[model samples]
Target: MFDQLIAYLDSVRARDPAPRSRWEILLYPGVWALGFHRLAHWLFDGELYFLARFVNHLSRWLTAIDIHPGAKIGRNLFIDHGFTVIGETAEIGDNVTIYQCVTLGGTNPTNGVGGKRHPTLKDNVIIGSGAQIIGPIVVGERARVGANAVVTDDVPEGATMIGLKARSTLVPAETWLREFIPYGTPCDEPCEQGNGGVERVEALERELAELRAEVAALKEERQVPARSRKTGAAS
Candidate 1:
């Protein structure tokens, strides 16, 4: 158990640079939260729903992070900082790094039946702060979700997702091969101005040009009619 704890702390240290020592990492709210979650999940598995819920609420109160007792989390699932929420049916894989203010939220089924409604994060996935991953989507292995992205669809392996609607950005092989990326964003490239943004900008520009041409033609038509009426009146 001590060896496992050391390994977990080392994993967190690899992802985070702020921690000076394993002792410091141990004091982190994410670490404490994960510990409480383990107890809660154990209780939940034994059908002690009330005790599980009690532990979950206590963890939330202490750590400011809410992870449902029913959520299945794998080893070294690091939650950097706090204010993160994992839904009941959410499944997190090994070495998945989630930043502050992120949500692995579930979709509301119209039939109102309880099932797998939350997201599943594959191994080595990194989620940035304030990102919302909704629905029962699969975030593929080694995928990176940028800060403030809203994802509702399945992310492909090794892809980098960005923007409000969360469009995939092509990442260079060198960047993708890196061990870890801070904030799940590539510093070498502009994430917000991706291919999708460029295409949308071009489309909007084309539409604006077409509208301008139509407006000019209408003005010309009105001017011609007014000139003809003036000429007839003068004659």
Candidate 2:
């Protein structure tokens, strides 16, 4: 048990540079929240729903992180900072790193039956702060969700999702091969190819310029005809 704890702390240390020691990592709200969740999950599995909810509520009160007792979390799942919520039926695989203010939220069922409503995150996935991964989507292994992204679809393996209504970024080969990227966003210039918003803006600017030129030509033609008519009238 102590060995497992050490390993978990080491995993968090690898992802976060702020922690000075294992002791400091131990004091993190995320760590305490995970501990409470384990007990709550056990109770939930044993059909003690009330007790599981009780533990879950207590954990939320103490840590400011809400994790449903029915959520299945795998080993070394790290939640950096707090204000994160994992919904019921959400499945998180090993070494998944979730940042602050992220939600593993669910969609409302159409048939009034609650099945797998929440998302399933595969191993080594990283979710950036304020990311909303909604519905029964499967975020594939090594997938990265950028900060403030709203993902409603299944993410492919090693894909980096960014922007509102999240679209997949074109990750360079070098960036894709990297083991870790802070906040799931690549800092390199090559990764800018995925910025479709910039391209769209440039296209709009070109169209506006063309429209202005056409308007100027039409005005010049009309002015020439008016000048010719005035000269004929004067003659």
Error of 2 at 15 (Å): 0.6
| Model 2 C-alpha lDDT per residue in residues 1-235, reported as the tens digit of each score | 9999999999999999998999999999999999999999999999999999999999999999999999999999989989999999999999999999999999999999999999999999999999999999999999999999999999999999999999998888888888777788776554446667698779899999999999999999999999999999999
Native-structure RMSD, model 1 = 7.4
TM-score of 2: 0.80
- For candidate 1, give the lDDT of residue 87: 98
Candidate 1, residues 26-143, lDDT tens digits: the string is 9999999999999999999999999999999999999999999999999999999999999999999999999999999999999999799999999999999999999999999999
lDDT of each: 0.96, 0.95
- After TM-score superposition, the amount by which residue 211's alpha carbon in candidate 1 deviates from its true location, in angstroms, is 30
Pairs clashing in candidate 2? Answer: none
Candidates in order, TM-scores: namely: 0.80, 0.80
